[model samples]
Target: MTRESSNPKPSPNDKIYGITNIKSYVPLLLDLDRLNYDSWKELFKTHYIGYKWLYGTLTQSVLQSILKPNATAADVWKTIEDLFHENKETEAMELDDELRSITIGDSTVMEYCTRIKSISDLLANIGSPVLERNLVIYAINGLSHKFTHVVTTIRHQKPFPTFLEMRSMLTLEERSMAKDHSRHVQASHQDNASSPTILTTEYQNRPSHYRLNNTRGRGGGRNQRGGSRGGQNGGRGGVR
Candidate 1:
């Protein structure tokens, strides 16, 4: 058999890093390093594959800044690490600010929660992990005011809600509130459509002469009482 057919070609999928998942790409690089250590040729081939993956995934600006004419995989990996590692603090702070400023406005409970968790993951990767309790607090604080009742109820309960518990409760509560609001709006529209005609019809059905008489009777009752009091005062003056 020919040595040319000794080894199978690497898969095309293996030529790409995690793409949007840079965190996973680092560990994969480490595993590749360990596996190829026994042979320089295999190691060089692995590095070349990694370089290709990195080149394909990186933006044009990033490629221009970091690309070396004859760079190995290790060289590309080290350059990426150095560039990102130097700005760890800045990255962490930005993540922290994002977490702090996140709100449930215009986003569903699930979306808001996902964003919070994403920021938390980024912070952890940057070495400034948020504690579970603090994360829970941040997530709750970012909720819309409609959740205040649910939040207050949860806080008052013993053993306080876990992050998962809070998330579940908030999601359920959001759905419930949405349903209630929809029902209320539908009912209001129905009431408006049906009630206005009934009210107008009732008013129109009443005799106009009867309404005039009723209005005059109420006014005359007040005027008659005043005149009676004045007549009694005049009678008392005459008796004096």
Candidate 2:
């Protein structure tokens, strides 16, 4: 049997901050570029540290595509920028399409709003930030038909609600509608359950001759009076 080595292989650094995509870290990279340009060597040490962290964080495929032997932080940064910056328009269009096509469906108001905000953030990073008014409109348009009244109410507001405020109102409306539907279902079930008992009680309380008396009319009342008078006359004749 071959003897195994007692020393364990070192694990990858878990604490290193990774950049998953090019869009999110552009601002940080730009700040580093400004520092590098000024020749702030003391401050530039931080950039070197960040560069190593980035190298460790990047996936094998990304590293293979962008990595240059003995590359400076600025070099790596420029490579990432060149790759992503060229495709900014395509990315922006895709994000815009995603924003426009969203519908509430089975998602809660909060969930729907969160998805919209996420898409907005991505668009902003690509230099196509959505306007606040347009964001509000997109949110309203994506809601279900049950929210028509809420949409109308929002539209009539003078200043209109912010995204957060609108989300809160919609969530409240969703809860209220759910509560009302629950009550209606419970009421329908109660009515169905009690129907047999109600019918039985009504039948039991009915008069024995109700069916026969129900057909009596104005002529029946006149006949009853005439019979009573005839009975009185008959008694008088018998006495005579």
In lDDT terms, which candidate is top?
1
lDDT of each: 0.72, 0.71
lDDT of 1 by residue, 1-240 (tens): 777689767676665433444434333322121221113233334334557756654555556767898899889867766765676788778778888877889998888888888788667655687998888888888877889999898778678788788889998998899899999999999777877789989998999999999999999999999999999999999999
Off by over 4 Å in 1: 1-65, 195-240
Q: Could you tally the backbone clashes for each prediction?
A: 0, 0
Indicate the TM-score of model 2.
0.59
For model 2, residues 136-212, the per-residue Cα lDDT tens digits are 99999988899999899999987888988888889899999999999999999977887789899898799968755
Residue 224 local lDDT, model 2: 97
Looking at model 1, how many pairs of residues clash?
0
TM-score of 1: 0.57
Error of 2 at 212 (Å): 32
Clashing pairs in 1: none
**Model 2, clash count?**
0
The C-alpha TM-scores of every prediction are 0.57, 0.59
